[model samples]
Target: MLVIFPACSVFRFQVSQGKIIDPPWRPSIAGMIRRTKATVVPVYFEGMNTLLFGILGILKPRLRMFLLPREIIHQTGKTFKLKIEQPISYENLFEQKLQSDVEIINYLRQRTYHLAHRI
Candidate 1:
């Protein structure tokens, strides 16, 4: 099974100041990883907020009232870049000695933001 977890509990836009505003990740994800023995893949998305906001400006109340239309969204001429980093193996987490769910999630959160810095 493939599961995607948003590290943050709430939706936050990427700021222009070049600093990522990362809130504490939900610890349950770490617990899930431990139970499922899932390999953690850190993926960072750049320019998604700009794209969505830009589309919102064009769509206005239509977007606010309804779901985003895929065809219109695809035609926005905005490019969203995704950086997929090396996966963290279940064994790797054990080797790192992350004993608690919080520690594991924090470690994964840091690794994810590290990719943003590279962009």
Candidate 2:
């Protein structure tokens, strides 16, 4: 920030030191008409398309279904996987009793900490 501020100030002073902007070419009559046509045509088409589709999508069920994902499945089948297909988080153990190794490790940890603090 300290480095950028002084450079920005210097650039601002140079621009304020008298200079005038001149466009390199004056627009010809044909160029102006082409620019106007290019701007108007796409805007008119977009507005008309938006209004046409907006009404049709609301009035037509098939068109609306084509535009949106259908909630109902065309085919139904029961899942037959016997075990979890994805990796599981250890947090699921919170609802169950701690396994034997976990209890042993925790007991050792507390015993070591208590002995060290007592000494």
Which candidate number maximizes lDDT?
A: 1
Residue pairs with backbone overlap in model 2:
none
Predicted structure 2, TM vs. truth: 0.17
Give the alpha-carbon lDDT of every model: 0.69, 0.27
TM-scores of all models?
0.66, 0.17
Model 1 / residue 40 / CA error / Å:
0.9
Those runs of model 2 whose alpha carbons end farther than 4 Å from true positions after fitting are 1-99
lDDT of 2 by residue, 22-99 (tens): 112222322332333221110000111133333454466346345323312321342322211222123332223544
Candidate 1 per-residue lDDT over residues 43-108, each given as its tens digit: 886653335544463456345224335533654876678888898899987799989999988898
Model 2 / residue 11 / CA error / Å = 53
Question: Candidate 1, which segments miss by more than 4 Å at Cα?
Answer: 8-10, 13-23, 48-77
